[model samples]
Target chain A: MASVLPRTVQGPPVPLRWPPEDNRIPREIFTDPDLFRWEMDAVFTGPVWVLVGHEAEIPQPGDYKTLSVGAVPVIVVRGADGQVRVLVNACAHRGARVVEGPRGNVLKGGFRCIYHMWTYAPDGSLLGVSLPDDFPVEFRKEDYGLPRARVALYKGLIFASFHEQTPPLEEYLAELTQGMDRVLGDGRLRYLGSIKVIFRTNWKLYVENIYDGYHVTALHTGFQVVRLRSHGGQRLVPNYERNGHLWGQSRSTRREELQPVLRDMSLFDVRTKPTTDHNMMVVFPSGVVTDYFDTIQLRYVLPLAVDQTLIEFTFFARADDPEDVVRHRVRQGPAVLGPAGAITLEDAAALERVQQSSVARGDNVILKGTPKRFPPYRHVDEAPIRHFYQAYRRLIGVPVEEGTP
Target chain B: MNNADDLSVREQAARELLARYVRVVDDPDRVEEWPDLFADQAEYRVVTRENLEAGLPISVVCDDTKDRIMDRVTVIREFWGAGGRLEDRHYNQVRPRHVVGPVWTEPQEDGTVRVVANFVVWGTPTTDPAPRLLALGEYRDVVEFTARGPRFRSKWVVLDTPVLQDVFVYPL
Candidate 1:
């Protein structure tokens, strides 16, 4: 059956112009299936810490959530011992998916795979298997337990890495933690719920769109209607030499000062902060954290295919927030950032058009804040996108020009 | 009329309201009429089946009040540049076609009607030839008769597809 199948193509679809210019990106990266497959191996599974979920999501014992690390499905579960484990969802017996749902609690009987009634504990330890006498004598249940990634926690944010060479969470995060700390605010959050939407664009295009600051007022007309301009801020590429994580800090016009577009002005009201300062961050590859207005949102980007991506916009509020405040956060979070959000729907419209046109085959050049090809770019500049591709090319083993920055 | 006959008459009125709603939403030019379908005090929300079953309060779109519901119309036309507004046309112009059927209506004791129906919306963007499936959901609604006509007291769109395939420009 395999011999009759068409030969698989390796490497990029089109020959990459070697040692790419800092501001120019090859359009082929967004449309190539072969390159996307290679990225799953080199970038996602390689020495990289991917943000899976926050501790607040699965707070109770035996509470579990299913997410993917690149293309590999894994379960982020809280054990009875109060430990959060990231375990592969596939069963060891016949390679069946142990868990099926997005989230649930398994405190009662643990994860019992209906495929063969193989039961595993909350900690992913194999408890029992149906009719085990038929198995080989050398088969040890201990060795057959689900494979788990090296887990790390930073202010209740859970990160998992399959590669042993992945750096410490703090080191990988670096200066990005300052912005995260400002947004997290002591790291005690209550999970409200998440709205997942599929963006018709490459995963990189979706992630890099956050790093871009130039598109705020141009593409999103909602910003223009309210006359909200960045008062003062800078787009920071923390660990630009290695990680190229984006930490875009900005203070926009206050709600009262903005043009009254909506009757319910609570959408743009920033009551929690003394100023209208907010933080928007991308944790290297696929995690998006933002504190825009009173909304605390974390977006997990999962690539479905070369031109398709799944973005789960998870919202949160302070655990100690009053009832009204929690309600405010809940109402404000998705309305501004989710799929039907006032400012968010435009990005989907724009990125999908870009994805559809990438087959035209040309270099998409970065012009904003690219004169010097280095840091100190304006808050409204899209220069940080260059560093993003730099880090991406490094992981994909594409030779970037020396001193490109 | 007898009890059975009266109930059927109420259900028929509720069914007409549902049919009118799909027609109004399907036409992009008639978006302003969307809010008029609801009562003066109403709640409109779009939530996923997974989240709703888990007892989560968050939703994709939570217009919990009539004011908020009206505000959505403003956001769609003015902010999203749908109604020939003087702003950058953000959303691509798409013709929304709702395939709704197998509706059930029950007359309530409080003089309101409980309505339920399964619906799937197909979006044909002006730019693309292919029409995409925008949403697949069940509408759990409540209707109240007023001096003008029957209006929706509550409209809850429960999505069967947990992962939305695309961003909807208008209401489902």
Candidate 2:
């Protein structure tokens, strides 16, 4: 069944270009079923380590949580010996999922299957089968243990990779590690829980939407009412890099700089004093960690298909924080990123609208952020997205073809 | 005021207070009335069933006093934060299951009347015309009757739903 690629076809023979330097992303990337399949193989199961969760999520031994790795469901558990393990949730025999709950502790021992009473150790080693006499000579319980996935941790953040060739998690994180470290800090963290929402648009749209700084002022004007009114309007100055990573800083005129427009400022006392260095970081494929004053937000994007994505928003605070401070941080943080969050709610609506609009348009969507006159700017521009497409082209092995509106 | 029946009446009043609290939240415009239903010293919390069962000290929403409740309402309505049109209705079926101590004539002076009830809040989103089920959760409240009427001294909302649909901004 895996070999059946949907709608696979060779485009009309055209001039072949190596590492094509086109800034525009083909619209098919969003809606093509075949491309989606290829992405699951090339990106998700490829050499990139995907952030599974934070260590704070399962702090105690025997504690476990279930999540998906691409299309595959995985269970992350902390054994009694104080080691974290990621195991494929599927049962070794009938392939049924072992744990269904989001999180819980396995009392007395390891996970036991309800179907046949197949018990496994907390670390995913096969413990004992219900019956031994019925098994064939070659049917060894040890060989039937739960399969484990490669797991790695940086600071307290946990990540997993299916491909053995993936670079070390630290090297893959690259420059993004600095920002992530700052967010985690030296303090221990507790699982503040998670909010999961499914968006109708393709997952990449969600990733790009968060990474693109150009849309904030116009798209999120309603929620930014206080920020704009206080700062006398702000613009995002984006800094893009080569490895499909981008960070942006929001610059706004201070109260003293624009005293005339800042009259009756007490009306918007809710606005925290503006900081010059409001940073937004995007780690390609998935994972976006943003730092606002007094609060930090982690948005993990899991793509289910070309048109479906599961977005989980998890909030964190210092483990030893005062009750009041933790509560304050949770409240303020959700105001920006949660389901009722100002920016995300609008983005959700926009994503739905874009999905509807794209159905009527042609096969290509132009990324205007990329210039056409000069060769697509290499370092400073939206070339990161272009670079991503270049990587996409290599993995999918798709020949570049041109089309007219 | 010194009659023996005053004790039963006060107990009934405590139950009535919780009922009124549910009604206020159901009424969209009257949601602002929640703060007044509590005493000057009140505690409110919104937490998940897991945390509550595990005896974990955490809540998605926690307010210490009427002032704090008022501040939350003010921020939700006027603050330049996240915004979406939502409709939440709380249905609390309060049953005067038991009375802890000897009923007292003056309800505020003696802490005898204790009322416990089970509640369910149905939250629906209005932004989308379809109006899907956004959240369903239970509420546990402890009420105390005062001379004026009944006031909620403490309320805890425990949600059974495992995955929170989105950020819970309004009281459930």
Candidate 3:
């Protein structure tokens, strides 16, 4: 069992307390304008580093992709010098997005703005000007280059933080790093492809939903029909940590469980032995890495507002995988998860419904998974939510024991 | 003059094939009719807009062989999956470009047509009850002429929509 920190700290070890063991999460967190403002400053732009993407997504030199860190749009580009850099997507002049496309190669060693042709190098250094004589001598090209956010990479996952005072990426990840490394298989990954879906729910809701095994049987009834079940009973083996990360392990059910329901359950019976434990890891704030069978799925949850989130699911294959296997993975990719995926679609629908119902009720939704029977179980069982809210309360400078109205 | 007449006929056939494909997928009453558009050895895929625009060799939804397509359709149509409640419609526009390939002298025995056309598909959903646009993309097709006219040998949905609205259930 894990240990609980206090709600308030004086000097170094801040004691954090979990909220009251009630199912209801305050409705204010979802709809309040002030809370959203606080989160943008304290959570998204705070000490935690948000995972923008895997390094494999932009592999070659000049390759670039756009990502959103909270509301700030950023461009992750691989330069000609073979270094990956993250820069604010906004132009230095009028705040226009320098790169409009999702992912591409700049080809000319730098990116040129479409609006005014203001060019910049891959490392956010100013390259050249469209018209040199127009600006004054004081307008230094060095000063006009793209602005960069603090960037770090763990295994191949790249993370960026807007705040300079944020903790080091490794220190911030803590125990969550191990689970991320496991998903990467020690940095052996290739870009398969991705499916980006926009959902009408708070980003936190999506993150919380990832490790909540309790919703699988009830909300994801489609999985049961498709014969996708855990070998180990329905309950998930939860591993909670001090950094607010949770990793759940479940056994893959035998083929027989799926045979009765699915007409073509044999399609997945490709003589491949399941060597690794099926794992689901939720990184603090907004990243979920799930290893389903042999496939590695990474989901980056980006918040648009208190009520909107953009969920990007990227599927990966081993870099040395056979051509047929790669093709097979691609074919099976859309079938299991993502917006086009059978299982993911249900989750998306359920999330939207949950949002709507919660709005109608206008009250705190209760979390029943809180463990109260034994003190030992309290840390591992009910502590994740408590840990999360404690982190939230600390960041937002809210009093934890403030009673509900 | 003979070449012009042949080109016109081929172009008309391509247009007809695309129209039929769209009609089948958009039909609310007969959903299964859409799957019948493919031949026994047909292939289908749905790729991202970014990959399509960049001309990258990656697909978000890929069904290589007829057996694979059958397995996918069977799972969704028969087996209960997560995206069971979605009702979608594909509105496509096709443009035929002349290319030198095997000209069809007669209908093939395997019910396959041999033709190529560039197509664009716009998908809209009825579930949200607000008539929302789901996806927009281009389709590069390889059609075969069967005894019953023309069918798709392969259809790749090269999407151009920035973000997928929700989930894509059926083949495009």
Which candidate's DockQ is highest? 1
DockQ (Cα-based) for each candidate: 0.66, 0.14, 0.28
lDDT for each residue of candidate 1 in A136-177, tens digit (9 for 90 to 100): 889899877877878888888999887777889999999999
- Tell me the tens digit of each residue's lDDT in model 2 across B1-172: 7656777676677766666776676665565787888776777766667656755444555565566566656545433233332221111111112112222222444553555444444445433344334445655566665565677777776666655544444555
Q: For each candidate in the order shown, give its overall lDDT on alpha carbons.
A: 0.87, 0.59, 0.63
Model 3 over residues A1-405: C-alpha lDDT tens digits? Answer: 111111222221222223454344665576555566567666766656778888888999889999787777889988888778888887888778898877888757477787778888888887887777967878988788787877788888888777666678777776666667766767767887777888878776677676466667655555566566665522222222223665666665665556455333443443233442566776667777777655677888888877888888888877778887776666555566657664566566667666656555445443445544211221123324544554555566653454521
CAPRI tier for the interface of model 2: incorrect
Q: lDDT score, residue A23, model 3?
A: 44
Give me candidate 3's interface root-mean-square deviation: 5.0
C-alpha RMSD for every candidate: 3.8, 7.9, 7.5
Candidate 3: fraction of native contacts reproduced: 0.40
Fraction of reference contacts reproduced per prediction?
0.74, 0.13, 0.40
Q: Which of candidates 1 and 3 reaches a greater TM-score?
A: 1
Model 1 / residue A198 / CA error / Å = 0.6
